[model samples]
Target chain A: MTGTLFLQTLVDGLILGGIFSLSAVGFSLIFGVLGVVNLSHGIFVLLGAYLGLALKEAWGIDPLMAIPLVFGALFVLGGLVQITLVSGAVRRGSLMSSLLITFGVSLMLRDLIILVFGPDVQSLSSSWLFDTFRIGGVIVDGARASGLIASLLSLGLLSYVLYRSKVGRAMRATAQQDFAAGLCGIDVKKIYAMTFGVSAGFAGVSGIIVGLINPFTPFDDTHWTLNAFVTVVLGGVGSPVGALLGGLMLGGISTFSSQYVGSLYPNVFIFGALLLMLIVRPNGLLGNAYKGSV
Target chain B: MNKQISRRTALGLLGATMTSATALRAMPARAATDGVIRFGGSLGMSGRYAETGLNIRHGYETAIKYINEEKGGVQIAGKTYSLELGIVDDASDPARATTLIQRQVDEGVDFFLGSYGSNVVLPCAGITEAAGKVTVQVGGSADQIFTQGYENIFGFFPRASRAWVTSIEFFKSIEPKPKTVSVMATNSAFSKLNAQAAAAGCKEIGLEVLDVLELPEQVTDSSSALATLRARTPDILITTTVDQNSLVIARQMIATETNVPLLYQFLGPQLPAYRESLGAKADGVVMQLPWDESLEFTDPTFGDTQSYIDYYNATNDRPFSYHTVGASSCITTYIEAMKAAGSVDPLAVRDALDAIDIVTAFGPVNFTEDGDGDPILMGAKIGQVQGGEIKVVYPENLRTAETLYPTPTWAEKG
Candidate 1:
């Protein structure tokens, strides 16, 4: 309606884009390095948030301080989860079975979470964080600002690991060609496990940030997962930078539409956009640059 | 001769005493007065409808605890006996709910308190009825729950359609005659049912219904629904969804420059999340609530809105959400019925519930058996979200505060 309003909406979109980018990056990492969908990525986010919430509220741990602890915890949890459930499917030697196996694992984790967490919407109430900053007469939530920061941090760390570590090299090798990598003396299983763990650890970080930003219900998992999927797809499924651009684009479009038109129709718009993308740029923004395909 | 006679007499007395003691010990562990009144609860404590289930469970448990403490036991035939409660988590699954109900029936549960969702309760009602057990649909608002006409099925919550009519009566009080209504829902059975009932109610009241859209349950984006409605320049928008979805919808509506008068069904938009997310957009959104601060009940502290809010906030410590409200209310109702019935006898509890007036956090609840034998409780209040808070603005005397948005000029005609 006004210049100030439009600017405010754009700023809001940027913050949301940051969150989308953070969440989708993990999914992208897992797919790029491990060639697995890891369908339970959403559940891992939930678990991470719940764990963070529990630590802060139940055990009196500070939310910020709990991040490193959560990251470490989820790293081990991810490895164990993959070893126990996905291992069986992997051993069976069918690519399609991996998806099915992960889907089942997701379902089981979802139910198990319900059993432990019950059916209540939980939040670590931080009213002090509800403050807003007026930038050029446009308002933005203070907590969302912090969330964007956290998301960027997670994304940066993930990128660093991918580009600068021994594990990263091994992961890249496997992703390029698993058989050749195995012949090159890279333990493919260990690389896959580590990549999954890293991906989940990033998800954990996103979860902590999200928990601070919004009230989480277990049912919201589907929305988050789908959002991540859409982000991954738009970003070329495996490119870190592509995921970032895709998140920003979708986030900006959705937020702008929500402000200018209506928020309810974003899903329809997203689907339409996806269809257009499929036709126009099947390889996505960065294409094969980020993904070393098998 | 004297010693022999004394010894024989003593032996006879000892033998008689020993036999009587053994007979006393051999009797059933619980006296017939303590006859096991097995009450079964097949509840959805997890999944989409978990909040309602959990809240109702709290009410039921607390009431049971109070009843036992006050009377020292359940009063039956002018005698007191201990009460036992058994429950199963149905996870909002209809099949699981049915199985749980049957399992409880086999375990000899006298009365059944079913969960909050219609999908689970409807099927569970059939299983309980088939087993000849009386079932109280604890907090389910499905209109058909009563109309099913099963002799043993009773809906503790008021019918959704009736509630909608009452809410509209309040809406009618808004200035210009409201028109161009938009109906949005989560597509869940209960949410859809509420939306359908509201649409029907609006039609009967001669209001224009525009843009009835059903969104998936976890719709994070509500802008499209708002934009579509905005295109029509609707005077009032009605939402039949949970607090989260409602807040998102309302906020998006405001963002889209369509700040029309709004009405909501059982799901509230006054929750902290809604308020926080909607920010200034939360003001003046009207909704239907079973309980309002203005409504007083016979239970000194029981009927006050604050008591429920306090208990809920004390238990949850967050902003009051409808999920918690509905859940707690249902649980509280069941517990009160159990307390009154005392013996855990399903028939007795159902009879007690039907006969006695229930004073909950909402208001006076009086159930009349329908032709199909389900109890129909008729009571509702109109609330509006103001400054991130839900306040009553209905029935004049029942109004806790003023209505937010005077009906838009466009709504004046029909």
Candidate 2:
């Protein structure tokens, strides 16, 4: 391939990677802090997109302006679900139970979205976002560039909240040892709810970006969830920076294969790479060695 | 009587009386001549195919309502029988669709309506055929359904194997005369067959087949695919996939600015939701339409095309598409067959369906021996989105608007 084409592919991959990284970060955060595999994470992403779309349609608010409202709505919903249903599963101390609970929640959310949206594909339209710009003979989509920027900003904010805040310290402590942290005067329950809320909030932001970038349907949740799961596992289950790296790797490989190898079998190359990663380093590039946490 | 009779004699007397009463009760409550003709089927009401499923259901419902309320039910054997339709939600799963068909069969439905999409319809066809019931449906255009030699299953839509022939012919007629084509399809039964046909059809017409990409059905992103298209830069890009996949491909093509002169998709571009979602981006995209509101055809049972559209639009919250028209035409076909055969017997109706030839809102309704609509006699029209409205642009007689040749690139479009 020509240098320009290669560079164009790389640029596209990076933009796509930004969205993938944001999607994975939320799933990773919940797994890290709550030790729960939130199966409904993808639905939360979709819900976020739909909420943004709804707000735009109902009140003529710009999608960018509706992000905070989407985030706030999802945060409250995540907190409530964590407290009401997920908490019991977590308290039971069975990873399987938590997985099943989240799976059920995912199914319910999927059906509810279908009920409301009627399973047809919907997209967010911004006139400015549809414009294209050129850089050194490589074309770049305005919406995707914006998505990349939003994804980076959201990830940066999440990193700050996780590393530099008192709540972050308490949340980390709770993740390491919930009972010990509770005894040490950390409100473990509140930390758990906060972690879910933050994870879902991240998902909300990712959703808006995704909706702006591509058309989505209620059935798209499973595919998005699978993509996010692959990203998180490849990057390391608990590391945001690792997720970014993993996302970039996945995006690059996928785009490169489709452009050069063949469009039909890109997934074969992508999952093959993930399989190789798993065999060589099961804990992922940045993840610590696995230990039985639950 | 109690004092005089022995226990055995009294028991025998009561048994005889009860047996007679039971026999009388077991007889038909209403005369056989006054019975209702029940048509049963399942639809994908709550899954990936829900959009098409709902449209099919609405079509059948509207047809049945029209027959009952307007035509005063289907006349059979010198008697008017009220048409009763029993539909179940299959949730877009073939196995569930089969189970629902079985349940409907067990309920003793006289006939069956086919489900939406080829995957669901194929299995449901097996059940209906095994039960010896006549099934007429507008969905499931895959060639396999016809190749199976299922005498009981009749499809109203043109075969998937021939679905793209009209589109290719239209492409050939363009002023610029496109030379190369790229075909992409989701890796599903119906889509694969359609894409294969499209490629073959293009090749037969002396156009170079640039590439054929068989993508997985669960693909949520099409950026990589668009990247490939941008590189190949075929004159025309054709995507034969389900609604969601096609929508994603259309959006990504625009987002990545893959500049093909002409774009066509299987089912997505034809949908009202496509225009609503993509706005001006949906313009210039071409598709094969089984029915459009502009058609001036009329069925004896459903009156004119406009009448069906009016009734359908008045009853349904969403605007009706060709799927609705096709499905309603299936019901119209059944009504015509029953009226011709003068019997509600499945075998008779199946025979009548095989022999009956008529035009409806969708188009001509004539079935070949394989139970597919005869392509030469009845088929889809090629349509393009002109000014946000789907206008029939092929078959000179039905052309509502002229073809906008060499569609503008994303950058060029207003």
Candidate 3:
């Protein structure tokens, strides 16, 4: 391939990588703190997009301007869901039950969104952001570029919260050893709820970015969810940084394969790479000593 | 042509027939009068294709609305009544559609209009047909539906499988014939069937098949598909995609900077999303379709499309899609058949559907028996998407505009 085309693929891949990374980090966060896989994470993202769309269409609010509203709404929704359903699952310590409940919630959420938004693919006029920014004869759309920036910013903020904040410390303590952390005055249950809420909020925030980049339908939730899983596994299960790197890597591989091999075989390449990664580096690059251990 | 059964009484008869399947064949023939014939439609309400489904629904409703306003409704024997139409959201689910069809049938509807996808239509039509209700498929073109030999079912949309060979014919008729072509499709039953059929037809025409790519059904992105195209770098890329997926695929092809022309069989650039997403990239994308708005058809209803477009704009605040074109065709075709039969008898409507030459806003449309003993319609217009317009360019008599983009050099180069 020519240098120009290769560069073009890389740039596009990075933008996509940014999206995958954003989606994966949120999933890993919930998995890390609560030990509950948020299967409905993709639905939260879709919900956020739809909320933004509804706000835009109904109240004439710009999608970008309505981002906070969308994020807040989903955050509250996630909190309610966590208190009612997820907390119960975490309390029981049944991972399989958590998976089933979350999957059920995901399907219900998908159906509800369909009922509310209708089954049409909706998109905003992204011409404001979809414009080509040229770099060395290769053009990358600004929407994707903006999404990448937003993803990085979100990740950075998440890192600060996890490392520096009071809730962050409790979350880490609870995740490492819940009984010990409970004895040390950290409310393990509360940490789980807050962590899940934050995780779900991230999902919503990233969903808005996704909507800005591409048209979205309710059914697309599953695909986004699946990609996030692959990213988390690839980056390092239960590790936020690992999820980020994994997302970017998977995105790069998939986009490159689509550009060079065949768009048709990108999934095969992605899963194949995941298989190789699993075999060679089970903990992933920059992953924790324990990945699926917890 | 003038049967003695009235449309309202036909509904009553249908209700009686559905009450017991055994009563379906023995419905009493009542005296016919042209009344406001109500036909109920169940289609993809909200799903991946809600936009296309809604457009098709608008087309049918518009045709019905116009016929009622202008022609005073379909004439039977001597009297005339306006047409009343009702549509329900099936959401493209078969089980939900079965319930909707049953509910509509129980409500004493005269005829039933089916949806755009086979997975939705096959079971829905079976329910309506089992009730001995005349059903017309508007959006869906599954070959099996027609081949099963159900007497109550009639199809308005051209079969998807047949369009490929017609597209090949159109390609051959072009001045500079395209030699090397690549095919790609999402591995859905509908898309795969179309892609495989088109590739086979291309090979039969002695055109070199450079590559064929099949992707998973839920391909969110198209980077890998674009790379494969760049690798083979064929002259034209033939793809069978529906809704945003196709638009995404097109955008990826453009984003990747591969300028190979595209030949799409299922969806055309008549969709606003297709043009909006691809912009300048859409130029030279050839779409095979059966209808175009610019055609100077003698049918007075042809002019009604503009009014329908206005209606859709007024209702949805957007222009009508190509799907609306098919939708309107379905409604008009059904009305004409009902007019010919002069009664809502399911078997009579079926025979009328077979016999009538439907002069639609789109073009002359009617079905003929195919090799599998199924009713399949033939013909498609070759339109090139250029400067955001899907301009019709083939079939000299029906040509609406000149080819938008010249056949790109990529179509002939090694």
Candidate 4:
């Protein structure tokens, strides 16, 4: 029975890790290539959830089915924000300017969410996503399973785009030397904007997964943003594989700490683990995926 | 005819004067401050508590509207003055709430309306107490708020877990009596006190206490905790958290197939989203409400519980909730105390409140001199979701339907 509980804990951690990896991958990518520390990353995630909710409520579109629509919507939105707000800060060349502007942008977006969504807790769901299955002595539910599958696929897509696609090489080149990439006839600013858009698109997709598992409100953005930063630091900066490792490790630490030590003790453990990892590997386990970026 | 005017004639003028917008707030009395009773507070107008805080404001507004527009405001020392509610959005931040309350105190506001959540209430209540002004709080019910010996902070909510203890008596009365209970709670101050009190209640009632697991603040997953509860297979599962957190716990429970005979929640089931979230699976889940339609407490302002509900239904901007009732009761309590004290002086009103014991639209209010947790006014009657509607099912006389005792298994609910 104890072994089963431990195994169930492990399984839950893995599911949660998939979600965390998906959520942070966008933040990691932006942090890797753009080096902007996009604080509004969580807003993009929440925007996705709200859009998914709108689609589901209006037309009975399942959250999974609403993903492409949400992704498209947020990609455009994220690009505009980068071009207008973040790009200004980036051009200013002040170290803290981008962070400050993004933070400001995040606050405005949060208010915008409240204005539209009416400041109430809302959720997205589907009748088909309500299944519970037991394999051996472990239990896994449909919402989380679906979330995991969605997250992995999204992460896989992101990985393929970053490592295999021509646009991927351009992004890496821009991350290495913006001046050199511009001289190579690559539009550095455009690459940065696309990376930001892709990052936002992934964040939105994760929001759909998150909404599947739990209810959310406009105020919940802070939690997602902080968790993404921690995941990036723990796993390795700016890589999908690092995000997965960090997310999975964070999930394991969270669930096991909750089960064994105490439920409220996970934050303490999470921070302690983060501090230890920072000491051991300043750039994270796999190290900065794009080392020359920052 | 009164005040040299017929009541119907006065109402006609008022009806014509009232604009189409009933989203009216900061209601300034048409009859100016012959004797003004100033009320103000910082509310969670823009964060997680934005909706709830605004509902509380509507509750205050509803009472003030009925009193000023209908009853011609408060009659104090042979002079009548209308109630004015001045509020600022604190965004549910504790430090901001504290600062906003102190600012109101500096501005010489007479009375304070409490913020919605425990986090905000704890800090702001101290500032009000220090200013020697009385704050009638609605939502924050952590027992320490009262036990800390602040005479100025009056709470509508009793001890955080008073209902949990009371519900035990109801639970024990059911046949096929439950012998074991498991508790899950968030780590919020209110929920911590709540879960502890509930565990104690189960034990005192001779039920075997399984585990009382605490979920983290902003918990993303509770699989291990739910799995533990499922393993123990307690007959009853009591979850303590705000409505949002409750959704997460319930979704996980359903997803994991953690079947407890009875699923009892502190906050979620009263909400429509609870039913919408769980669909048919919400059936048989139980909680208690501080105010309900069946309550017959006569209110001086709204006339009775039903009348207040009528006013709330007619004019409130937010959805129907016990919170609206509690917020109205905050205003009603102030008005009654003012009438008793017969003066607009803050100290006089404070003394009146300390000595007053009256049943408002919400329920009975009898504050112990120490102002520590009082169960008499906690007044949360047990309710269960039956046929997709929440119905009272405890304390025999208040039972709208029989208890879904030994609630059906998850598959059985399906």
User: Candidate 4 chain B: minimum summed lDDT over ten consecutive residues — where?
Assistant: B19-28
Report the backbone clash tally of model 4: 0
lDDT of 1 by residue, B23-52 (tens): 786443345335544557777777666766
Q: Give the higher-TM-score candidate: 3 or 4.
A: 4
Interface Cα RMSD in Å, per prediction: 5.4, 1.8, 3.1, 1.1
Clashing pairs in 2: none
Tell me the spans in candidate 4 whose CA falls farther than 4 Å from its real position: A287-294, B1-33, B161-163, B372-374
lDDT of each: 0.66, 0.83, 0.72, 0.83
Per-prediction TM-score to the true structure, in the order listed: 0.73, 0.93, 0.79, 0.93
Question: Weakest 10 consecutive residues, lDDT, candidate 3 chain A?
Answer: A285-294
- For model 4, how does the per-residue alpha-carbon lDDT over B158-226 read when each residue is reduced to its tens digit? 667664655787778878888999988887777888888889988998999888888886667888788
Give the backbone clash total of model 2.
Answer: 0
- Residue B38, candidate 3: Cα error in Å is 5.1
Worst window of 10 by summed lDDT in candidate 2 chain B: B26-35
Q: Decide which is better by DockQ, 3 or 4.
A: 4
What's every prediction's RMSD, in angstroms?
9.3, 6.1, 8.7, 6.9
Give the winner by DockQ.
Answer: 4
How do the residues A1-294 of candidate 3 rate in per-residue lDDT, one tens digit apiece? 487678767877888988899877878877777778779989988887888778877988877677678778877788888888888788888889889889988989998987776667766544454455667766666567777888888888888887788888888888788899999998877777777778778888888888876778887887778888789878876666777789889889987887777666788889998899889987766554341222
lDDT score, candidate 2, position A266: 73
What C-alpha lDDT, on a 0 to 100 scale, does residue A151 get in candidate 2? Answer: 84
Q: DockQ score for model 1, please?
A: 0.21
